[model samples]
Target: MVALSNVRFGKRNDEVKAIQAGLIAVGMNIPAGATGFFGEQTRSAYAAWQRVLGFTGSAADGFPGCSSLAELGARAGFVVDCRNPGAITKSSVRFSRNSGVAVDEATARAFAEQACDRTGAPRSWVTGVSNGANLLTLVFRESSFRPNAVNRDDVNATGPIQSDGARLNCSRGYAQVIPDTFAENHQAGTSDRIYDPVANIAAAINYIWRRYGDISRVQQANPHRDPAPY
Candidate 1:
């Protein structure tokens, strides 16, 4: 980390000089007689390159401070790692043309279809078919649709109920639960679906009776996870 830090600030070091050279080679628009300081001008150029690749972050100073730039570079076929601090970053796009996510249109369609099947949602509601499809997002974002990823360990939760970090307690998977006492009381119904995407999806649609379902309670039973009464 320190080695790269020095490389970023050197005035006469050729390696540092080389970095500035590459930045200029790609049209950095530096000031006249640039002294290899890796200053604002160079940062602007780096930031511009990052934007071209759809990264989301700022380029302040010249350190590439563990921001969106590193991740952007990584996603754009670069082995760039933010944790490494300063190191020689290489772009995968430069050497290997056959890189990037492997998912293709056909496969994505199949995956979407499978996701819909698992959710038991109408085939017409699937993407490219449904008017407002949300099954895929629910599976991927909230639960990863994998029972193993339920995140049973994350206990320091601020939200009412969380299925790990993805599915907020109030907002159930795919359903986007509303935060309310009644909503929280309904969480028990989802325990069975802790890892079953299909079951979880079905539970969301049931939206069992809320206001009228349990009027004899201190507050409305947790509506999102209300347990059945004996």
Candidate 2:
């Protein structure tokens, strides 16, 4: 285990840098110019990591406890509970993609709720179609980066829709917001903020809602596509 000292804003140490590196390695967004100093930016990034790991409220406070440090260090996959962060299930979206292992029902439900909340779809709609719809995000996520990452080559890309014929100049974060989508839907920010999980998910849901209306419609439109079982 990497021994890390308790850190808060204003501390400067290699451990702080290590923490930043760990979080970044796991797809959390630390500033590109992040120095070894623990500042508000680092704390905010840390909190975002906690949120992904299913921590919320006081538990989501931007502090690095031993467990959080270990989680960062381990680089194990984490699941975000849309119900709340209080009940996190450790599942790997990467593993499911790479190994063809299906995500568990709980994770599917979480994704269903999260997606529905943004689209104003009924919980039952997602639950009914969660088996297939969840896979779209999971499989599509394979082509996506963490909220902080972008394809180096595609950084300058601008397109409204992602397609094979056109260069896929858009895709980042969990939901993979393409350039055109970002221009139309994003709140206003470029670079790292576009990769923010909340921002990306919101943009993704918005895109999906605008295109498909609801989860059931999404399934209807893409009947042959299959990523996992419900």
For model 1, the superposed segments whose C-alpha errors exceed 4 Å read: 1-3, 7-12, 57-230
lDDT of 2: 0.48
Clashes of 1: 18
lDDT of 2 by residue, 1-230 (tens): 24332243456776677777777877778766458887778878888888888878645656655566567776743321112111112220111111222345444345436654543344554434533454235424443323334443555455433322333454554555554564444432212244444445545544543443334434332335544211
How does model 2 score by TM-score?
0.34
Candidate 2, 8: how far from true, in Å? 45
lDDT of 1 by residue, 1-230 (tens): 11222233223354445555555565555664345565556556655655654555322323343343344334433333222121112210011111232333343335445543543334443342212333343334444333233342343123433424442432332222222321222223233332233333333322221211111220112223333321
Residue 11 error, candidate 2, Å: 50
TM-score of each: 0.25, 0.34
